[model samples]
Target chain A: MEKKNTQQEIEEEIKSKGKDNIIKKIFSWILKNVKFLLIPASRLEELSIRQIEYEKKISKRKFIRRMKSTLTIFGMLLIFFIVTIAVFAPWFSPYTFDVLVGIAPGNYDPPSPAHLLGQGRLGRDILGRIIYGARASLTIALPSILFSLIFGVIFGVIAGFYGGWADSIIMRIMDILLAFPGLILAMVFIAMWGQHMEYIMLAYGIIGVPYYSRLIRSSVVQSRDLPYVQAAKVTGAGNWRIMFKHILPNCIQPVIISFTFDIGGIILSLAGLAFLGFSDPQLIEWGNDIADARLHLYEAPWGAFWPGFMILLAVLGFMLLGDGLRDALDPRLRNIYGAKKKKRKKGKKEENDSYEKK
Target chain B: MTLIEEKTEDSDRDPEVILSVRNLRTYYPVLGGLFRRKIAEVKAVDGVTFNLYNKETLGLVGESGCGKTTIGNTILNLVSAKSGEIYYKGVRIDNNFTNDLRKKIQMVFQDPDASLNPRWKIVNIIGEPLRILERMKKTREIRKRVLELLETVSMKMEHLDRYPHEFSGGQKQRIIIARALACNPEIIILDEPTSALDVSVQAQILNLLKDLQRKFNLSLLFITHDLSVVQHVADRIAVMYLGKFVETGTIEEVFYNPTHPYTRALLSARPTFDPTTKTSRVILEGDVPSPINPPSGCPFHPRCPKYLEQGKSMACSEDVPKKIHLGGEHYIWCNQTK
Candidate 1:
């Protein structure tokens, strides 16, 4: 009875004051529903329990099953190995990449006890340079790919969602960017911005935007007219909200699969740029080491071989991871695998039942 | 108490018309050539008009590409009408729908799989309308309201945090219904809501729709290609052929005395289980003509059985048919029958 009287009083107060002041009315309504504003302890416990159950269910989903493939595990291990080497480069490397240990003509020494992976033309320890090179390669590639993804998704969603003059204009611009060979475009960007590491990364990043944008654009276009998007519109969601919140999540799987592949591709391209003498000579990059070893390839093949091998390993690891991710992320493929597993289990159960009857 | 009595008396005397559509037309342009010029226009919806009374289910039935879905979309403003006026409770809302108007009107789309965002949980999907239209910011309030809606649709609490893919087709439709009911919408446009479900599930959904209608006094614009489903739920029926409505009447009037030849052919197309009764099926010859270059005069004249029976007269080929009133609230557009 007391609670009812207080509620009625608050309601009456709001009715009298709300006619003149909207803010005061809102405040009074909030006060009236204060219990709802601060959730009760019982509700909090229930929500936490629900969340834990949800997480447990999610972990056992098809994606997890697909991730358990042998090749995917190998790819993950390979990436972990490279990342560990990169992180511990300073502690692990026996000599600085820039230091020349051997004297004069003997600087181009073969593989020895002192320098495990032989020496470059400049007599720098190949293993030490390769370890440090992992850091430089990742720093450039990861951030650049992320940059491309952000801008590409923005442009693609806008072009595909609005889809009229905006679609034509943005897509044509992307087409123009794609018309230029990727290397040539990167070179042009590097030319304009100078040969600094940041400029090189920016060039690589910009060169990649067209591919990501086109990929996201096609997916966005296909999903934009889907009934769910229309339902969101009918529910009074704005164009921006519909694009980012509803449509983007559905169309982003292809973009995610493409992202992993592009990391390796960008790393290779950076090495190519270095090989073409666009990179700084002072930098202890894999591509720079390979470039330095090119002259001594005939006498000591190990110099060029080590750096080339590291690039190959890095690229192969990323490619394998990308392939695995593509298979895992595709719901159709995941379901197919799941069905096969179920069928096998059913077959085994039937065989066991028959054996017991026999 | 007197105000409530007076409102009931008013309603008893005359049924209130909640939504009125006047001469609605929606066209899609086909672009071609180097410069992407508008080559031709597909008349998806050409001049459709109808009124939906409060607390009544108005079923809009048609064959594929006959503008049934287009009409629903035009009312929702998802598709811009080429020329039309849509008045919601006497105020025109075709191109000018306020947030309040939007809150009162919602849609349940066809294809349970396609209608839901596969990525979203049932709670978020059902709570979306409340968050957007009502500005209900508190999570607890929204969840409580969502729970109420789920119960209204007969869905369980365990389905809340699960994704759409986790549910069967029927359950997904129920969740969609819960989403549509989140804001307590006065009118719901159901575009073939059960064409994708099994027959048993279809019957269950129809019963749920009927129950929800009585509970909330909702005006439903149920669009479907299936006539039996329409017969089970609709209070009134509008039969569409090509891009125009061929007939509109109460369910008994339309079902019992289908005046228009197109409506008769459509009614006769419904399959019957009784083998003893020999019913002459009105098989529509040829196919629905392309809406891009629809025949002159009556759009249905090309394949209309009456037109063929009357020797393909020039009158049927040259003049557009006018509406003929066959007594109270029942009318059809057919020159030959009149």
Candidate 2:
């Protein structure tokens, strides 16, 4: 009767409060009732599972913090600088990329105070062209990669989730696309359609679809039979709902990681396409600048060097960031870097102690 | 007053039969060798038949691979039935593709952890069926119902915001139970609901289930290999062997006086708590035969104690035994009957 009375009293008290207050009271009550003395076995198991999750989250944060590798940092800075220069192109460059503004003829000049990266054969400012070229490279890479990702993920998830004739037919089509070398296929696409920014991006995105689709397909296949997927089906969730809601979230991590690296690869491919004269001649692009300076490669080395250097820097930055992301994302691999850092810290502490003793 | 006694007023009164299954067979093609050809068919649930009364828990007890879970899933239409007739409230729903059956019947899986979506909050997890089937559109209405369900399973309303991983196995099961009850289901198929839980937690969940069953007046199809777990809760028990029901009866009829040799063997295998009473455990010789190629005559004849005792009679090996009724709902499938 006393137990019943107290319970009734608590319920009445809880009811008196608003919903938020009731939630607070309930939380407090639970915290009070969690018996530490007699820890249940299931509770212990739950604690360990929670512990593993907590450790994973903490390790992930720590991994991300420690992921600032020298090359990754350098790459990030380079990308950041390039993007900044691209955004403020007019302010950063002294002269327009197309206009001949140099004091020398043949439009090619050696290094001077008035012009920073010397001058191209066309007399267009090399530094200005490179700054403006960053815009073209980034615009082509980011949007095309996003386009490919969206299409790839959709096709792959659908194909993998609904395996059978769908799987075989879709995979065979992708295989046909994959059979052609990426650059060669891009060239073929350029030939069929007139070479333009849109055409190049479409060609690049089309070729990229096969690779991402295959990656996402394998992941979807693995996660498709995970018990939660079956649970969702049992709950009467539609096939599309199950594919998007249940399976996609679980299988997208590795795909996202690979996507970063693919960005760098896409940038390189775009540059190659531009170098092959696929882009508009009026556009101030890195590969086009490099191609323009090719005739004067021996006469003035500075013309080719600047644009080529920028391309290398951009690619290296993207690749390094991708590598760092890979190391940071996976806990097991992250631990290797973590262990080395911890060892270095320990060694430094030991040296400090010896110095104090001396 | 105790919840059990409070509800026992109508214990003797016969409840209406809510769901019935007749000769349900679920088979899977066993592909083998390099070419992935269909070598043979494994009859997982071969011709199993039973009736579940309203507010009654019919325990389907069996060995590991004896098709108890398969039977439950087949009834729920999770696995396509090879052949059978299933009636829910007298409607022939043999091959149902609609959501009406899902609304009527909800199932709780064996593994609580696996059964729940790890990424989803308790509200969405439990509210999914309500929104999908019941069309409970308003968030306020859904929240109210979800809270009521949580309370029904002895969980707090605050638990609504939490994920499945945040709770213990017992608590996760309570959430699953809450989800099962969200639709106000007529029948809840518990597929080894307590097998994955701790022994103490198992008792709590069982008690919770019993209370919920009585409160909602819902029928239960409890599937489990562990006989003792169902012994207390089930009004009637069915013992299965090699994809077939060897024996079935009321709890007392099955527990106290099991007629089938397989049932007797199963009963003996259940460890006793009493030190005083002695029971020579019925150790049946040889492993349970594969379901792909079940014995020609009686499935249990090869491992039957009576068959060996009666000098391996030709009747035991050559002829199939019809169900022999030993008075008042107690039926056994065997050649020799006392």
Please give, for residues B1-338, the per-residue lDDT of candidate 1 as tens digits: 01011111122233487888877889999999978899999999888777889999999999999999999899999889998778888778998987788789989999899889877878899999999999999999988989899999887666676678767799899999989988889999999999999999999999999999999989999999999999999999999988888999999999999989999998987888897888888998998899999888888898898889878878778877877779877989877864
Whole-model Cα lDDT of every candidate shown, in order: 0.82, 0.79
* Candidate that would win on lDDT: 1
lDDT value, residue A70 of candidate 1? 77
User: Once model 2 is optimally superposed onto the true structure by TM-score, how far is the C-alpha of residue A220 displaced, in angstroms?
Assistant: 2.0
Kindly list the per-residue Cα lDDT of model 2 for residues B152-222, writing each as its tens digit: 88777656766676577998999988988888888999989999999999999999999988898889999
- Model 2 Cα displacement at A292 (Å)? 6.9
DockQ of each: 0.45, 0.23
Q: What share of the reference contacts survives in each candidate?
A: 0.73, 0.37
Docking class of 1: acceptable
Worst 10 residues of 2 chain B by lDDT: B1-10
